[model samples]
Target: MPAVVETYQKIKDLRDKDKHEKQKDYQSAVETFEEQAGALYEKLREKEQAVEQFNDTLSHGSVQAHAFVQHRQYIEHLDSALDDLQPSVQQARLKMEHARHVLTDAYVEVKKYEKLIDMKEEEHMQWMKHEEHRHMDELSMNQYMKFFNR
Candidate 1:
């Protein structure tokens, strides 16, 4: 192969490796985001359940004022924590999407280089075949001339 084609092949190899790494990063990011979202939802559910239980208690009988205030405060705290966690989950999702884009670009680059290398190799093979045929024709012509002269 020509040096230029070899160089392209090397570049393609590097891009392929980069694509692999990007895929792994994307997978990890997705997993992290999923875990974060799951935890957030679980906490939200717990908070909801707690509020429902508190309401049921109030409906059933008379409750103390301090206990009511404390339950409200606990619910508020859970709400605050959920609010804080939402942004981090969004950030993780964004990171995963970005990684996916990078992986896609790397895959395209590798394919482009692969096509270029294939074209170059095909051209080299055709040129070699043409040269071999020309050489054979020349040898045939020489033999014909020798037989005619004799």
Candidate 2:
């Protein structure tokens, strides 16, 4: 409960709050990236399935020529779109990783501040105990002198 310990406690509280906010941000980033990747994969699967079904229909030998070309072009467009999305997904993953690192650093800072506060409190407690014992000794010596003199 010394002034120094109080200051350290205040710092620790601020650091802990910062750490909590960073943790939340990291978790949100992770969830966002995961959802994006999952949706992308699902879309890729659907596109691949569509292309396969179109190929199967072509083998039936009753499709119109224009419809065939249009289907092929649409599949090519889907491929290009998927390719374009991949870099954005990669960027999201990188952003999530950065958030995780920032959260970790914030947590470390909080712990260090907490440790410092604990050490300061311990030192203060020890000093208080030493002062109390010295005061008690002084009182006891005064009483002993008074009793002998009387």
Candidate 3:
């Protein structure tokens, strides 16, 4: 029974480790998405600032028409890049959710194994108690018989 409990404990430990790894994977996915999204936002901010600056210069009659065209083109390119990254961000979020589900399943598995071990340990304790009672009864009966024979 102890051996059985031990085996279950080992199984639970393995499940726990697997769950931890899955959690790490989920966290990593989240971090990666955050990094990507942050970078895109930063780029968008820079582009917006550049556009504003260019507009200010144009208003002051200090910028060339060709330079304004180039800046507009760059802003359009940034917008397209942001559009491309939206899908990637969604995919990363989905991946993280999947990993979270996997981790939850692993946690459930570990709990199940631990519960089995606990049940087995309780059974062992009951069995030991029953055996001890039987042993005491036998000893008492032996003494009674000896006393009667005397």
Candidate 4:
């Protein structure tokens, strides 16, 4: 194969590898979304349970001091967890968005690379023809040199 053809093939192979890495990162973003959403959902459930338990204790006409104390602590925990989750959810959303963008860009890049490879292959064919012409000229030169020597 000509040098140009070889270089084009090598470039195409590297593009494939890059595409694979992007896909892996996109997969990881999906997993992160799942993890963030799952944890947030569980925390919301805990918050609801805390509020209900606290209301029930009050309605019974007794302080239930120990239960109230524990419920209050749980409420605080739920609030704090929710606060932390907000920023992480936003970050995950951005990561997913960027991953999607990269995937789209990769698709476009594949087309561009295909065009480039085709062009390079055609140019290589032209180069091969030139090389063949040079080789024939060398053969004639060798014959002339032999005649002169004789």
What lDDT does each candidate get? Answer: 0.92, 0.89, 0.87, 0.85
- For model 2, how does the per-residue alpha-carbon lDDT over 20-131 read when each residue is reduced to its tens digit? 9998999999998998798789779979898889888978778988998899888888888788878878988998999999998998999899888888888888999999
Per-residue lDDT over 35-78 for candidate 4, one digit per residue giving the tens place of the 0 to 100 score: 99888889998899879877887888888678778878879988
Compare the candidates by lDDT and give the number of the best one: 1
Model 1 TM-score (2 dp)? 0.82
Instruction: Name model 1 segments beyond 4 Å from true.
Output: 55-64
Residue 66 in candidate 2 has what lDDT? 97
Q: Is candidate 1 or candidate 3 better by lDDT?
A: 1
Q: Write the per-residue lDDT of candidate 3 for residues 63-95, one digit (tens) a residue.
A: 677997898898899888888877887887788
**Which model is ahead, 2 or 3, in terms of lDDT?**
2
Error of 3 at 11 (Å): 2.2
Q: List TM-score per model, in order.
A: 0.82, 0.80, 0.78, 0.62
> Rank order by lDDT, top first?
1, 2, 3, 4
Candidate ordering by TM-score (highest first): 1, 2, 3, 4
Better of 1 and 3 by TM-score: 1
Error of 3 at 55 (Å): 5.9
Model 3 segments beyond 4 Å from truth? 51-68
lDDT of 1 by residue, 1-150 (tens): 778789988999998998899889989989999999998999899999998999999999999999999998999999999999999999998998898898889889889999999999999899889999999999999999999999
Error at 58, model 1, angstroms:
5.1
Worst 10 residues of 3 by lDDT: 35-44
